[model samples]
Target: MTTPHHNTAELAKLARVLDRQDPADLDFLATLPPAALRRFRDQITDLIAERESRRMQRIGAAAKLIPAPIAAKITEAAFGPVLAAAIAGSVDPARAVAIASALSPSFLADATVTLDPRRATALIAEVPDHMAAATARELIARGDYLTMGRLAGSVPDRVLRAALPHAADIDLLHVGYYLEDTDAADRLLAIVTDRVPGMLRATATENKWSEAITLLDLLGPTERSHLGNVVAHQDPEILDALLTAVTDLDAWDTLLPVAAGMEPSALQRLAERPIMQDPAVLTGIADLALTQNLWLDLLPLAQHLTPTQLHIVAARISAEPDDALTALIEQAHTANHWDTLIPVALALDEPARRRFAALPVMHRPDTLSAAVTTAATHNLWSAALPLVDVLPPHTHDLLATTIATLSTPDFHAALTAAPAAGSTTTLIRIVLRQDPTARAHSLTLLAESDDLESLVTSFATTDPEIWKSLAALNSELPPRLRTLLAAQAASCGHSDIAEALAT
Candidate 1:
């Protein structure tokens, strides 16, 4: 009942809306009355069907223009089993490709089965993008993977992009494994990513399609990074499946760089996955982190790991050669990634912790300060204390000075724990740099220690002004302790401390 002119006007308006429909406009379409929406969809479907019919008619009309002998040779002699063998041996592949372009996709798809696969690939390359896309869809429907894989890398981008919606996820995976053109592979994947979401992950896990992983190697860096982001956003279960597959296949060497490109939240999600809890997996990731200098990328994720997982990762990091560890530290420092290091430092065994703290990269004043601050922020004074012993004196003093500026609870906690950890001298020096209030707290803590005499002796020799500060808090000290401290200060030639204690 519709007039052609009205249908044309409506189709033009629909085209404009489809072209201009942003997310909000798309949502607006959802709000249309159900009848109207159905009518609109039906109209679009009719328009698409008409467009395709007209395109085929044009293609068929063009096929008529090809010399009748060539068309006859293609349809009769170039394809059927007996004639195919004769024509394939005699025809130039380029001419066959040209003749195939004007033919219908269904006829070409049937004919290609008889053509030598290598010649078919050559022929496909010269076919129009749309016809090639249609042929690919037909081939997929026929379960003709040999043909699909041969042509996959040769298909034009617009053709592959158009064909993807018609292909099955499993078929895509099968063909993806054999795709030869990296650019075509990347474009197909981009389309898959947009349309199928988790198909790659599902295909890899459920089907154990290890060959599909090779597609990653073919992707350019930009495409690989984009795929990494897409993979990163997959559900944890999908990620776990992917992790298991990659580990079983030993694909970390290829996958890690993509992982390293993920945003922090996505990386954190990956890090916290249960698959990462496996010791072997953790070790592999650590090796990648060190080799790729991805400490900055890996560290934040480290914080979300369970203590046991962290310990395993810390041990693996510790086992790296000293130079590798040093380089790792240097990269972390240059990237200002101390916050990521803090959790790992806390998880290391004492010897490993000390080793990490002693890395030459840890000697830089700013790096050292950042490390100490991160440790302090996490209340990891025990982990941080060992670093003081390995650091140069000035660096040690700097760390101590920074620790003294912590909140009262953190400061008091560090002071209380230092003696047991053998960092008392370091803590005392840090406290000495503080104003009177902190000095008073330090003096009270030192006076209460069982090793008060050793602390007093050390404080007297190291910084007499601290000894003077302690003596000024004389009333706060026990009477017997005050006598011992006065004798120690006088022996060290601190007359001011000796006179103050006597008062």
Candidate 2:
């Protein structure tokens, strides 16, 4: 047999191991403690129970407030079970009743043994109570329709009929039937051809909408019409059920008013449901949204809609053609959204083109170049030609060169149509700067013109031989122009060219 001292040492070591294990393992280890370990185990139990009690109290206090921050903190503490226990244990029946009704099943499971029939009954009265079949039936028969209906709303008929005598509250009965059985919901709806509007209104609040809709389905044409008016005028929650009722009966007239009154967010949610997956509903929402100028409201629904539905939404609000084009240009310039600008430019009308031309050059050169090039590419030459002067400097040069190359016939005709002086001299000089030619006529053109001095200065260094030829050929040109050419030659250290000019 193990000695007492030896067992105490072993138990002490085991307790230390248990401390490292989970809380549940510690409890299991407590049952196996040696005689000497009892004191340590008792201390651990007392400390844990006290900590749990404190945690429960904190949660109980947080449940009283509905503020988002407080609720979030309470949820973070994982206090649902503790809160449920407090509710089940409370001596004050009213507070206990409210807590039991609101606490979810997962929460109730966490509560200590305080979960009982009275608490479950109170929960059934106010909220959907998840309970044993017998308990739910007992609660229903007690004329506690709130708890009975809510519980029956969730459970099936074998549980529901056990307590209630008759299906007097047809809405509640339907809820109970649906809970007990879906066929029951259908059967109850079939018999109730014309329900009292008050029952429908109350059921609407309880979110027993399937029952309300079943009643509307049984209504005759005239009865349905009057019911639609009643549904249209109810509070938002009730009106929401009415929308379902209309959808059930395919009552478009009734759907109109309730859908119109719903908040945009709520309407958008309804529009996306499979049951409400109708083009007309989407169109109605779009029309309402457009009238209110709810740009943001239509955006989320865009992905859910058919192409035709999208177009209807797009049409409701008129786009300013000019503004759209202007925005396209800005986006293209800033974000390099080049593709966005192409269709915009192509679609621009004559008035729009004129408007574009009237815009500042510095603001939209990229767009203007694209527009002009596209016009030219499509052989809108008349439109393209005039845009050259307004294009940016490099763009103007490129388009002009392209036009001169491709439309040589038009180019030559244009030259004769509007003759310009000094243009040839300027072009030849510019060409010479790039690819210098010392031909006699080119030199003569350079030598004879008083305006060509800058060009002469530019070229003298390039072809000192050419400047010497020009100065020798023309004596009457400005002396300064001749002298400057000679100096340019000397600066280039071409003594022979300089001496030839001097002679």
Candidate 3:
């Protein structure tokens, strides 16, 4: 339609116009004839492709000469996706790693995700420790948990150690769960211990415990035990959450053994949690302890529980068939766990408490002393009073003498509990041997009895000093009761006690 030179000039002008305006602003181009528009679009596409190829060539050439620091700056200035593609396609892996190291860890980590997978793997494997840690934090912040999992096994131990402090528990758990190179994971966790000793516990508690349980299998026994120690040191709420997860998931088999390995103090802390007071939970733990021969391990921990918690354990254990109860008691005795068992015994229902008191093992003097001391110290006189009847006469005499050693409040508590437990004879014998200060309280208790006359007569004959002590209490005693005691002492031919009582 036009001469060739004129058409050439028109096409050149159109190209210049397209360049001056945005190539994307194609409204005017669309108004041109179809043939003209097609040629124009084709020319634009070819020119763009040629320019991009030349730019990449320059970048590749410049990359070989620039030091990593300068190269990092250049790459950071370039569009992120284009820079990623250029590095992946044209840069040597070693050089790429050097430049990546020089870049901001966060920026490089974002760029890394856009890189081809093979390139990313190669580059990540070579990142220096500091940069690797920075990248790990960036990945966590971005919630790129899957990528973190993929990279963790390939990262060095020092890098992981550096990074763990910055990691969130959720991300760490996610990575730990999926990391395939267990040996690498193990080394990584070990390094993590140096920086964040509680990482395993925090991660396990922050995530679904099933994932944490699966990750535990990757660890050796020592590491797992260390992790248990860490878990035991966590807050009670965290431990409560862990127990709830274990219960909800029915993962006791997986968890109890770990608990069994905890240090005594830590295990004691776990035992003292109110959550451990749940009857089902306590029963489950008890069954596990019995089956695993973990009574020695568990009893010390149980010793730290609150009385209410001990009561729950005692009730549950006592309700077990007689054989199980027998096994529990026998194991506790053999383990020298009386300090642990005494509280549980004191918390038992009357029938159960009496049943435990009747066990032949309770008669051993050392065992009896430990039980009586613990019960008295904790004010479990109700549990202790009943045991008096089961003691052999010599043990009874020993216990009567021991009761005399109690502090004032404990002494009064024992005397008050004795009559209710039908151990009045034991109390009477104990009173007969007590010092004046103790005998005064005993006299007050005896004065409440209808056999006040017989009690006074027996006391005057058995321990003449008790009458001297009772006479000292005349000012404090009710007049009528004092008169009765004096009349009884006089009739028994102890006019000395009668005369003192009348004063």
Poorest stretch of ten by lDDT in candidate 3: 1-10
Deviation in Å, model 3, residue 451 alpha carbon: 19
User: TM-scores across all candidates?
Assistant: 0.59, 0.22, 0.47
Tens digit per residue, CA lDDT, model 3, 11-92? 4334432544333344444345544643664566456445566676667667889898887787788657446554544567
Measured on C-alpha atoms, candidate 3 has an lDDT of 0.64
After superposition, which runs of candidate 2 have C-alpha atoms over 4 Å from their true positions? 1-132, 139-145, 148-280, 287-300, 319-503
Residues 1-503 of candidate 1: C-alpha lDDT, one tens digit per residue: 11221232233334432544332344435434434643674566456445555553454455456774577555655345323322432344565556555566666677554343333454545556676678777888887664565456665566677667777777777666545456767777776776445566557456643654666655777787677667767777677777787787677766766665656677777777778878988888777777766566577667667789989988888888778878877777777666667668767787887677667677776787777776667777765675565565556556655665666666656655666657766665565555666556655655566666665555435576668666767776656667877887789788788878877
Output the better candidate (1/2) by lDDT.
1
Q: Model 2, 1-503: lDDT tens per residue?
A: 11232233334433432444333334444444244454554465446445566665665554556544444344435555544544333323344444444444334333422233323454334333233333444433443333333234333343444333344454353433222223433433334434445566667656655545533433344444455455444565665665665555444432343333344454555544544445566555545544444323334334344445554444432233556435435644554333323323223344544455455642354655555444444444332333332333444443433333334334333222221321332233222333122233333444555444454444423554445445555454345555756666777778666666666
lDDT of 1: 0.63
lDDT of 2: 0.43
Q: Which 10 consecutive positions of candidate 2 have the poorest summed lDDT?
A: 414-423
TM-score of 1: 0.59
